[model samples]
Target: MSSSEQPVGEVQVHPQPAPPGSGPWARFVTWAGQDTIEDYSLRYAPKSFRKWSPMACAITALGGIAYLADYSIGASIAVSHGSASAVVAIIVAAVTIFLTGIPIAYYAAKYNIDMDLLTRGAGFGYFGSTLTSLIYASFCFIFFALEGSIMAQAMKLALHIPLALGYVLGSLIIIPLVLYGMTALAKFQVWTQPLWLVLFVAPIVFIATADPKGFNGFLTWAGDGGTERVTAIGVGAGAGVALSLIAQIGEQVDYLRFMPEKSETPPWRWWSAVLAAGPGWVILGAAKQICGAFLAFYVAGKVGFTAATEPIQQFLGGFGSVLHNDTVALAVATIMVLLSQVKINVTNAYSGSLSWSNFFSRVLHIHPGRVVWLGLHIAIALALMLGNMFAVLNTILGFYSNVAIAWIGAIVADLVINKPLLKLSPSYVEFKRAYLYSINPVGFVSMMVGSFFSILAFYNVFGDFMAAWSPYLALALAFFLSPVICILTKGKYYLVRPNPIREEIEKEPLWAGQTLLDIVDQKRYELPDMVHDCPFHGGTISSLTCTLTKCHDLCKTSAYIDSVTTATLRNAAEPQPTT
Candidate 1:
């Protein structure tokens, strides 16, 4: 044996490998999804694969967030709290989301990593991020169920399809669309952008111009409960409900990971693309919510409050106002609903698949590819749809907003507060499994403390006022506690092992356009920093060890090259000796 060679068992394997296809229905699962593209579920994205310009990538990401749920959220709040209070809550939520999203999006784009990977590096640690994945996965499916329900409503009105069948069709339609992952999603979002904008905006404009009286009335509308005054309680409650969307930034960064490097692009263009596609999404989203409120008020006057909450019914009233022809109005309303829901649900399924991939990979040590998770995600959402999740939308969002806000707030605190102010966490985002702790208390403890107390408040354990302020309490606790925990723990738990050598290699100029296979095949010179997961060995090992006879044949198989290897090859190819 060579002096540099180490036995495979030297690298510890946690939880074992499930005895090679031992999970329930493992064979069927492996057969169902494409394994060719790993989607960088567990690591950084390499430069060679980042083909899109910043502008194109930003727009594609923004397309996924362009859902009609804003309208639904806005309408639901307005219906309960009145227009003035709902408007206040919408503004607060928008500003909060926009501000926090900036740092997260920038990191994801700059590092070529997704939200899960970003979270791991930011503070959650490797397996610690698994909990967050479940949180984010829940966000995806919750929204998926909401968006799917909206589509089902559209189908019922247009094609006279039953809600149950429509639910199945809506959930199933996204499966094929999302099956191809970001490649198909980017094109789908781009081509549909123009049509979606037209359908989305045209009716609102028509309503404003044609129905002057209704438009005027919408501005001063009060809640059905006769809450005309905008109290702090009402605003807090409304904001909490709307704040359930704070984690949508995760979905935005999912696509932003594919953004072209800023070094190659003009400064103005890069910043503009990042801002517009990142936190800037909330600007338009906030406007949509306010617009939803207006439409809800207008529809309420015509068809009563209960029916007014339905986007299909609300838009139908708007179209009917101008079109006069009932059949034509129904057609336009249905088309708008279908287009909007389809666009957003595809994003939901895609993001969910990524979250689930991050989760299952860490917990189960199984990677069946993202498509299988996509199916599993849609299946869960379909069940939620069948249960009629939309009917209790307010209850669902009100409770969910706390956990979502806690997750986002903890990340935001780490990025904006803990990293810079306290210097408690590392500056660079380190996501590779071999380098991170299984859990990090800074984020996990803060999130737990925040969620636990807030959920208590939500259930009225502390009484009515605290119940109404639960989401805010969650946000405040998580944001404030993150830095506190970091200080106390001295950020010791952030890394279970020393930083990987790839961190230094990534900074080297000669690292690009190289792969582990190149070294193993003797196509390129071996460097100490060129690391890859050896097929014969479970852990990431440097190409310097590629000469070992036991691992020589395994390195030839490209599938065993792993997702992180290409990234390491492309970004950190050139290595320099340590001082």
Candidate 2:
């Protein structure tokens, strides 16, 4: 028998000590690190913590897409570039988002990791993913400000509050709710879903019933372009703006990581939850955009084209059709706007916290906890809200789409093509800092090259046509370049060392319900729950290593092996008595 296959009875088990430091600051940090609140921001989410049912996790994820920003985006696109162009643009963007989101969402749920962690193993490597983390964080705060702006507009209409003060109030209200993380968010989203659905659907139903002719008029509306025919530039520009939402898959995976393991849940239930909550979010999002375009057309005569893009006005006009009383309609409209914005902004804030946590932890090597970053994220969003970011929303989103799609495209290529087809990257994700290179050229170089040329195209360096089509250019380059670069580099940068735990698993397979001892912390962990690589040692460790003891340095090359297998190997090696 090998030394590693020694008898289980011969091995000694030692209990690990508590985390260092008992100061007030340390205590506060400890408090913030609570599993119920922090939700494993910096590491793999173990099976023990992913207790929520797949359906429940899916609902929570879907609830985040309830932002009223889609209404504004759709309305703006339709008004700027005719209904025909808007329809094509919305469909194209939705299809791209749905297809790209599938591989990312499936990998996240299967691996029990977030986007940042997934990026590390996919191709970007350890530090290369930090840039994507910044991109994702920017997505969260940008949308938070946008959603907060909508809420402020509703407050201004309902209570006659000033927009500046309303922005502050709107941003502040979500702080308390998000401070507790997934524990608070899951319950809150599920509880409010029924009401949000009713409010969301009622206005569309009422508008269709009361104004049948208005729907037809919306179809013929030529917009500011004064042409119903779909031009290439119009489709491209509108799609660019809509594609800014591609990063939303990051937010979806944040909740999908909490889904119960596939082995634990029924196969049908598992896939259904993943698809429904993952890429399926864009289905409702696209419908909402089309509905917003129609609503904008319905109210365009009463309010000017510019004012029609505002969600507050759209809902007010929708409710006015149903409720004859102007005061009641205004009140109901304001309530719906508030409800929608609140649901989405909380998600924005929560996902932003996780992104910021990942970014700064790698950069500064110090994590004050996700709650501190939560405050930072909200502050940045508040600043944007006060700056009237909603006024130039299309311009900002159009430009941002170039970089956002490049990041997502590179990830998708690595997941769908490189790992599966070329077999350059590993089949499994390796996110531990100990095993990953600081950066990998396959994904990092592809994103950089894609973003550089796309930005130039966006600025009209090539031509007006190329400028409008820059986002697609970015997507294609990143997607194709990832595999080419992987081939050129030969995948040497993917891992610093072979994963010893995985090597051991290949030698002797572990089954469910089996118990294994963690050699470092000396704790017993069940089969699948103990399979995670230790962030410090780059070998198998107890899932609770960092959380239970907060000790990273003490473990060196630790691994989990089955006690029964060790005993059998030991018995076979010993001399048989008088045989």
Candidate 3:
């Protein structure tokens, strides 16, 4: 009831039960019950919360996918499967990605929850979703290494930056930019997007304009063996490498969550932005892959056998062929790589921190802040770089794609099909720990089954060609199986209970951590600004730190008090206010 500033360390919050008349325990209990975030989870996504236009979100989401590795990944596929095979693989992967991402992007934007929370509410429960979080976190680091290596190579090839220095430069580069979250990321992407587009298209334009044979070379390119001569296994193996990039959806959702709520003013633009920037990003990605494949073939034609495998070399040759000076090509290439990696890695680093924070805060019950994890994630990628991880990209990414595909497939099924048509589960997303089972058989069983079968397929246990297309196997199986499991289970695994406080808040509104929770047992709403979700005895009046004190009374037995009681106790926990 007191009008005081938030305090520092050990701050307390919540209701005062006494009408200047109640006993100490009752008042403290009322206060303790009011500490909110402890029992609350992200709920009630609303239009008011979506402040950005769709265009801003699209750029931010797609910005991270622009790594020069597109060239390397495409080249590896091209060299292995021939240009035609790589072309087929690119189209297949792009179509697959767009379809898979549609549900995820729409759900994330509509629900205003991150992927981890979505996993929990979709069908995977608290502990079950943790597996996805780990999967997602692993995706962040793996891509961080891949993208960082590409940047480092650009540095090394263009500026002659020592590989060691390039590694440090590449790895540390994202931390500074991602620290600010989506706000800073949006501006950064906006400023850089134009130049990225220009640089990306320019070399292709020049190459095509100057050497029309370049196009012919790409089409007729035997590439070790022509397309018809392709072994199914070769195509499958190459596709697996490209499919690993499917996990990039996690990063895309990080931005899509910021998409402006749908409206009539510019409905077409909004939908266009969402489609183009959301899952539509795969179209751009596939295009880049085609470009990569073409340029890789061009480079092989020009550079001969020695450096044909590397895409940066492919790019350098493209520029040398298209431009006047080799030095100019090199400098432009380095800048392009630096800009591209910096953009996407900022997203990787940013999205990773959110992923890691959600991991620890929910599982371990602690949050130091988003910035701390930024450093930790980048450090991990740095360590991977020292190990020269890029050297083994093909094998590493191929194995990783299977699990990533399975996870995505399970999630997309729940969002697109499960929640909408059958009405077996609620359409509005629910993501709170207090109301979910430790595991949901629907998503969990589906993911496990998919992963199991896909891995077996990958190892040639399901025959040779199947082994090559293991990621697709996982995707297909998980997507088909998740809903079947949901139907058989009657979709019971989705929620523990509806938000108890829905009446007080808007329906489907996005909630911040500070959003108050009603701890009905203690009869008051928790104060929203406390640093600790748990009630504290007040220590100071300066900031959130001083806003709490522990329960002072001997009568209260349980440490796990409700939000309202915690709020009451926060007031009652302190020395009585001098009248």
Candidate 4:
């Protein structure tokens, strides 16, 4: 291992072309065979692979956020601010998270870049964005622990299971499912999302509709000292913690990358689906927070105030009132908890595996495949669960949110502002490691400066409003700093150079105006077709039109998309070349 560790396929700048004329499969497999995923996923999400619609993707993306903590947030905010102040804080946070999430979702879908790739082009460089990956991975593990803890808590409540075993089961439950990646995740989310929503909402619905007077009291009720005053400082403190969720957009983008490119489909419907699934998750998330508050308030009223912050308790208690059967109620809560955790944790596990693969590959030049890192990632999450991270959800999430929001805010600022008005960054996104600098000052610097000050404020080092909503301060600082850095640096770090690569020639369509042809050479054979050679896995695929086996595209005229490759054409590719 030399000074750097980037595995052969982790992604790199100026990747050498497959040693001049290797077998087509060998070359294709080498260039894009899917190196442990993090880097492989950095490139285009192929059309052959895109199967889910935007709606399902959105629902699944929002599935994991069905966390028990929403109740805790609602109860904490309500208790601290009274119902009125909490309502204001929830609304402010929901709207802010929604608006910021929109452009991010759009870009991820349209361009097919994961959060890391988006950051690479937005302002962060190849290595620079790894810091953000670390930040993002932190969310995954921490949430992993938090969600597991909630499940463990539920287990303790419903079955008297040990918290330790519950923790182990909660984290491990997602392992086998996520191993299959999105294919399994999509089905899991679809089968379970409806029940989760119903069970999650039934308690709030029954309590509110049944007791309007009680609900009214909840809304008007003030905290111990909250009466006769609306302290902006108190409101800001509550709002700050809520705003930390702004980073949740990164999770949304992770799935949005699977969205198929917009085509002849009606622009309105396609855009709407992407929009609804992407940033629109914030709308649903905010609604859940409100719903959580309602549940917490109702549960507290029915079962005393001390237990208000426990969501599993609140939801179970609420569900029990309507179901009228202890066993049924128990089952619903368990199903709800398991489904929500799997939906999100699978995503967490999947995204985290990719992140670590990229980090280790780039820094160490190793490619251990996604499965290897997937195990490692779960281990980290398992360790955290064992460490009792669940008990300190507020502290861990609050600090993590500061860094996550700063990174996300910088990327958003570049996409929404820098690319359009200033023209500092490119219009399209690029994720190849070969095409980016090790670090870009624009995103990297903005995030550090923002996170540094924001974390300080979070610790009460800044005093006053700065202390209460430090995460928001980080968001603001990053947003302001990204463009400022772009202007100051003149946006040189956007890309070392543009990508001119086409992974598969079939990806390009033969249009109505363009004559299409496929020609194969029989005599100039280089190697036996694997379809013919490999007997272990019988050639399960065959297509006369688009043969699954590699054809003589290497020698065919149609094979050479251009005589010149992307590297040779980068200087040649004029931005937005004419048809």
Candidate 5:
């Protein structure tokens, strides 16, 4: 090799070429493994592909929150707990979601990794995060089923379709949109956002102007018994239902992972996109919940308590007030429902694919690509919809909130307390499998202990008051227990070996415009500040190749280095480095 093509790092063995296949099935699988389908599902997102502007990423992330389940959740809480308690519960949930989401979102965007990867590095080890992957995947399919049920309701109302067939159709429609991943999702979200906003706002605006007295009635409306009042139990139960959405940050970070490097982007734009798309989702969510509560009150006298809790019925009543013609109102409401469900379900499917990909890749030791998992995710969700999961929405969400909050609470404690405050964990996220222990007791034990006690509380093992307060118990226990466990264990399980690349970057940062050559591809590419070390070959490789080559066991050991290349770069201003 010439002086300009010197290898940056030495290795005992170079990366061998992937085995080739030329048959039709091989071609199809190759097509399925394209960037759009793979989407770095089991690895870090490289800077080369994260070209979208901050605002575009933010808008795409925000689009997923348009699901009408918020309306249903809000209405159910209000009807069960009364408006006064619902108000307090919704605010508490929203504030908690916003606060917990900040560190998770910031880390995902900064590191160009998804929520699963964030979890791995935050506190959970390589295998420890697999459990969280399951939890997050369950959240996706559950919400997908819930959102699809709402769409099915619209189809039943508008076209007289049976709920079973509507369930199949609703699940199938999202498949094609999600198959293309963020490439299609970004444009689809941006294009549909304006129309969705208008439809979303119209009902609230109409009710305020046309039925001004409705607000007064809503304020004093008692719940199911006509004797329900705000109480500690009522507020706890209501907040638990609302807190089920804590897992939503995973979906948001799936899109936020495509955010451009912060060093290249303007500071104001970067922070704005991260915050707005990340935790800021709850602002709109809380507003929608409040709207759901008010609209439920508006329509309850006409539609009865049960029907008032359904989004289709809620929007239909709101539209009926605005458009005097019942047919026009139903048509508009159905369109709104269809649009809302499509936007959010695509995200649910997309995020679920990522979660399942991470999960199976670790457990099964097989790589079938994300598109395959997308199909499996939709299938699971379709089954739930056909099973009428929506009928017991409150029951399911209330039970689920305990486990989900415990998982998130552990992650938050690791990010906010262990990593930053206690300084027990590593500063950077180290998700690659080779460097991590099978399980880290700090987060894993904390989550399990929290889930166990909270779930018992949810089952009324303690008392009615504890049953209502299960999610809060989960959150508090998980959050505080992580730091305590880390201190007790001395944080040794976090990484099996130190990362040299991160250490080098901390000591002296790499030049932003540096380039490195990949020996496997025999092509030069701009070097990322951090690169993964190939544990099998003991060669330094670009992080991009780590994903592209499907070399699943790379350690991300350290900075690219060979004695010659290091000295060359130190002396020459524009030295060429190879991996």
Candidate 6:
């Protein structure tokens, strides 16, 4: 039997690589097919693999966020608060999302790390970031289930299928599509971009052309709240609900992390790609949210509040006005919902797997693979779907936004304030587990305080006014508190130990007559000259190494890189057979 298949006690000293087409599914299950290391789970994305142009990557990343959920969210807000508040809230949320997303997008692309990894070095520290991982993973699955629920509704409307089975099919469809990761997703997004854009705008255009009265209705709609003019509480509550989307930057980072190095690409192209794919997502999202409000307003008079809030129903009504036939309108709306849901859910599933992988690998000290986590994320989302998550959409998002905003706010403060203004934190992100402290109070404490207060306010613990503005409170506290804590701690907690090897190499030229190990002190380092494969980053390198004990203590056990010698040592340390 091959070494990979052999029992643990009889592990091979030098296991041979699996031959071509000899994997679990003959070939489809191979790591190559799975885009094994392309997404750079445990390490930085290398320059060689980031060959896609910035525009190509940006468009793909933007395409994934082209979901109908924005429409649902906008419609819900408009239905509850009226057109003025919904419009005000969407604008407020868009501006906030755009501003906060900038620093995160730049850093993720520049550093070549996902949101979880970025959170680690930005201020949260190594193990401190585990909390954000959970938050991020929750964002993925929650949105996945939400997007899936919408797809199921479309299925019920278009195919006349039962909601129970529709939920299962909707949840199951994206698994195979997301299995291949960014390589496949990039293509899917690019190919579908034109069609998605066409369908997305068509219903709005038809409303403008065929039913001008409907457009006017959207202008004066007061909604179920019976508030014609925007109120402070309404705006605050609406913004709070809308700001829950702050975590979307984390999703954008999932794609931005794949961006090629800026130095290698043209300056204009690189910056354009970074901004467009990063903070620029809100541009499109804002437009969709407005369209959703418009549609909700147009439909509310005919279908009632609850029914108007549903994207499938809203679009069905919109298309019905234009198409003049119920069957044709249903077909068009169903196809739009399916296309949009699939586009977004693949992203949700892919990012969730990455987040879960980071969280589990750090917490459990083992990572089976991204594919394993992918299935786990989908399964959880499916469970949520079965529980009828669609019914509690507003409650779930309003509550979730507080936690998400706190997490993003803290990270942004560290990047924008601590890193640049005060220089309290390190200028460059230090994600290597070996060099970072397990917990940095700067981000962790700030996030905790922010989330705690915001959540309390959300539940009316802080009274009605505070409850209405809880998300702003969360953002304010996290953003300001991060700098305060960084100043208080004096940035000493950012690193557990100084990385003298990295320090020494920075001063020398790349072509200097010395290897990276030549600068590393042999007495302080371990496994010198042997290649080290980072368990977290999935990169193989020979420039640096540390002892198993040191690796466990500093890097966390799961992120420890393995050299040939270390592998053999690990094997030897395993319990020996009896006579």
lDDT of 3 by residue, 1-579 (tens): 332333211123332234465665454445333322111112223333445777778877777777777777777788767877788777777788888887777777755567887888787876788888888888898888878888777777777788789889877666667655666778888889989998888778888788877777575566755464555676678789888888887788777766655433277876677677768877788888888878878878677633565656766767766676888888877777788888888878877877876676555544445555666888888889879888787788888899989988888888877878767766666564544567998888888899999999988898988998999899989999988998998987775444434322334233322233222222222222212232333221111122112223211223434544676778988898678
Residue 432 in candidate 3, Cα distance off native in Å = 0.7
Candidate 2 residue-wise lDDT, 1-579, digit = tens: 444664432222112222677965565476454656677787767555666999899999999999999999999999998888888889999999999999999999987789999998899987899999999999999999999999999999889999999999999999888878888999999999999999899888887788656677666688766458787998899899999999999999999998886666899999999999999999999989987887788788899898899999998899888798989999999989998998999999999999998887777666667777898999999999989999999999998999999999999999998889989898777776656777999999999999999999999999999998999999999999999999998988898666656445434543323456775655445443353555444556644343243344333233322443466689999999993
lDDT of 1 at 208: 74
**Residue 56, candidate 1: alpha-carbon lDDT:** 85
Residues 424-514 of candidate 1 have per-residue lDDT tens digits of 7877677765456668889988888999999999999998889888998998999999999999999998865444455555576345434
lDDT (Cα, tens digit) per residue for candidate 6, span 1-579: 452353221111111134576665333234422234325454455444566889888988998997888998998888888888889988999999999999999989976778987898889987899999999999999999888888989998889998889888988889888877778889999999999999998998898789877777565578887477887777788887788788998888888887876666799999999999999999889999889988888887788888888899889988888899999999999999999999999999989988887787677654456776787899999999999888888789999999999889999999998999999888777776666788999999999999999999999998988988899898999999999999999998897654544454335323111222212222111121222333433433332222111345623343342343487789999999999
CA displacement after TM-score superposition, residue 302 of candidate 4 (Å): 5.8
Estimate the lDDT of model 4.
0.66
Question: Candidate 4, which segments miss by more than 4 Å at Cα?
Answer: 1-42, 222-229, 301-306, 324-327, 500-579
Candidate 5 deviant stretches above 4 angstroms? 1-28, 226-228, 507-535, 541-579
Which stretches of candidate 3 lie above 4 Å from their native place? 1-50, 224-231, 263-267, 302-306, 500-579
Leading candidate by TM-score: 5
TM-score of every model versus the real structure:
0.85, 0.87, 0.80, 0.79, 0.89, 0.85
The global C-alpha lDDT for each of the candidates, from Candidate 1 onward, is 0.78, 0.83, 0.69, 0.66, 0.84, 0.78
Backbone clashes in candidate 3 total 59
For model 6, name the residue pairs that clash. 42-536, 42-537, 43-537
RMSD (Å) of each candidate, 1 decimal: 7.9, 6.5, 9.9, 10.2, 5.8, 8.7
Better of 1 and 5 by TM-score: 5
